[model samples]
Target: MERSETTATTRLSTWRQVKRMKLLYLLLLLPVVQLFIFQYIPMYGVLIAFKDFKVARGIWDSPWNNFEHFRTLFSDFIFLRALRNTLIISGLKLVFGFLAPIVFALLLNEIRHVRFKKITQSISYLPHFMSWVIAASMLVEIVSPQRGIVNYVITLFGGDPVHFLASKTYFVPMLIISDIWKEMGWAAIIYIASMASISPELYEASDVDGANRLQKMVHITIPAIMPVVVILFLLRLGNILEGGFDQILNLYNPLVYEVGDIIDTYVYRVGLVEYKFDYSAAVGLFKNVVGVVLLVTANLFVRKVSDHGAW
Candidate 1:
């Protein structure tokens, strides 16, 4: 009887706690519903990756092909080329783009003047808000072989005008540079916020110990935000296969397809343009599987090396 009364009291306490937080629970309803409708609901279409989907027959009625699409996807040379480019481009961006924000944030944190810092941050972030189409248009105007300011400047220096947008030699570098230019400032916002949260007392103590700004940044600021860095790195690893489709689609042309093509663009060409939906679905599935594997591997490696991980 004592034990039964104790269980009843515990249940009553739990109920009262939940009752007190009812409004907070209600606040989560919209996001949960949106996730279900937009994310989880679309997962059902993944079945088309394994099936010979026809519009007339619809997704449910489509006949299964038993990995035929996957076999075709693997055998296609174009798909392999796209896959290679995706890895190369995404890898380069991961290395350079990942570091850009960290460096920018650290430098911004070192800035003592408040007004100058805000103005600089605002200017940096403005480009991130611009659409890829607009950014690509601006890039094209700047790099135009015939009348662009860049080529004109080169000519004034006694250099030959080179076609940068159409040249495979410069395509990848341009992609990386443009991407960093657009996103670095926005990305640094998180790191700057993280740096701001570090204790002022630690910096004071470091100053007391004769530590300079650089030394304090290395010891206090970076260490305090190392976990955030690790988490962001892991999240980026999950997108190792995504090579910025919108930017590439807008900026790339047939002349640069060999070096600029990526999995997402290939999917758009085959699935949407050519109406080979199943093949595109197969390619997408492969990309997603690789992404998941990379994310898991990176998470595991990070966990082994440090205390931080996605989980």
Candidate 2:
């Protein structure tokens, strides 16, 4: 009798499991359908990179070029410059941009006045919604040698007006600063959310132990949010090759190209404008390969060192 009851119970559980799975599939049917239609369907076009990609002969009939495109891309002069500039810009942004948001989040968390904190956050976050083109125009206006607010401030302090945007030496710094200004508050939103999850009891306990605000922040708050920071930092390592293309493209001029040109702009100018599709595809493929390798390596390293990883 006991064995018969156990078998009947098992059969009932299996039926319930099948019913739940069917319900889940019904709920997910639309999103899965959309992903297949839009995302997976487009991947078939990547074959163009492997072909000579003649317009007359569709992707199916285009002759295979094998590695010829890659060879030409590697030998191109501007490709090297673009690669170097991309690395420099991305490295700077990764280091400085990453830290700025965390610092801002911490500072905002310390604010005792709710209204002041909200006002400051709102003001800082407003710039993030502005388009890159509009932001670039604002940057040009502010850094213009004559009649700009920055230059006017310098003159008021008895200093000569500096043409910040015109000089290549200052262009990278300007990009970093402007990007930080636009993104820091928006980026801090995640860190702030992470910080909020930390138990209030931890702060109270530290206070009872004679810990000051700064000490509590350093010892309690920072440690609490560190896992989120580590995860974000690891994720960022995957996209180091992208290098804020739209912002750089909008803000840069021919004079600043040597220092500010990156892979996306390079690909745009050469592939779309100049119509060297094969070469541009090769360069883009190279960047994607590096990004994939970095993501995998970083995830593995994080897992080994901290036991926290993307996977």
Candidate 3:
């Protein structure tokens, strides 16, 4: 009888706590519902990957093909080349692009002038809002060998104009540099917020020890944000195959396909253009499986080292 009373009291306490936070929970409902509808429901369609998918038969009625597409995927040179390019681009971006935000955040944190810092941050943020279509078009104009600003500068230096986007020599670097330019500022916002939450008392204590700004930042700010850095890096590692599809699709041409083609663009041509949905789905599912493996592995590694992870 006493145990039953205790259980009843615990249930009542839980109900009261929920009632107190009811509005907040209500606010969370929309996103949870949307995720179930758009994200979770669509996952059922992934079964088509293992099936001989047909438009008429639909995802459920499709006959099971059982890894035939995957077999073809492994043998195909075109898919292999796309996979190679995707890894190379994604790896380069991970190195440069991931570091960019942390560097930008640190630089912004150093600026003493309020108005100037705000203006600089605002300008950096603008590129992230622009669509890749518009941004890539502008980028093309900026690098055009015939009449672009970059070529104009080269000629000013008595050098012949270079086709930056077309040449494989310049293509990977261009992609990495452009990606850094587009994403660095927006990604830095997370680091900036992490920095903001750091106690000012830590800096004040460092000042008393005769620490210089660089020393204090090194010891205090960077260390304070290491967890955030570790978590972000782990997340990036998980998506190690996500070479920027829209950006490359817009900017790259046939000339640079050897260096620029990625799984996404390859999938686009196969699925949408050629109407090979099953093959495309299999490739996508393969990429996603690889990503999940990487994510889990990275998470485990980070947790072991620093005790910081997505969990």
lDDT (CA) for every model shown?
A: 0.94, 0.89, 0.93
lDDT of 2 by residue, 1-311 (tens): 99999999999999899887997878899999999999899767667777898878877898998878887777888988999999999999999999999999999999989999999988888999999999999999998889799999999999999878767889999999999999999999998889889898998898799999999989998988888888898888889998998898888888888998999999999889989776677788899899989999998998898867788
Off by over 4 Å in 1: 1-14
Question: How well does model 3 score by local distance difference test?
Answer: 0.93
When sorted by lDDT, best at the front, the candidate numbers are 1, 3, 2
Model 3 / residue 92 / CA error / Å: 0.8
Q: Which whole-number lDDT from 0 to 100 does residue 77 have in model 2? A: 82
Cα-based RMSD of candidate 1? 1.8
- Per-residue lDDT of candidate 1, residues 1-311 (tens digit): 99999999999999999899999878988899999999999989889999999999999999999999998888899999999999999999999999999999999998999999999999998999999999999999999989999999999999999899899999999999999999999999999999888889999898899999989988889999899999999899899999999999999999999999999999999999999888898899999999999999999999998899999
Of 2 and 3, which scores higher on TM-score?
3
TM-score per candidate, in order?
0.95, 0.90, 0.96
- In terms of TM-score, which candidate is strongest? 3
Model 1: clashing residue pairs?
Answer: none
Task: Please state the error at residue 128 of candidate 3 in Å.
Answer: 0.5
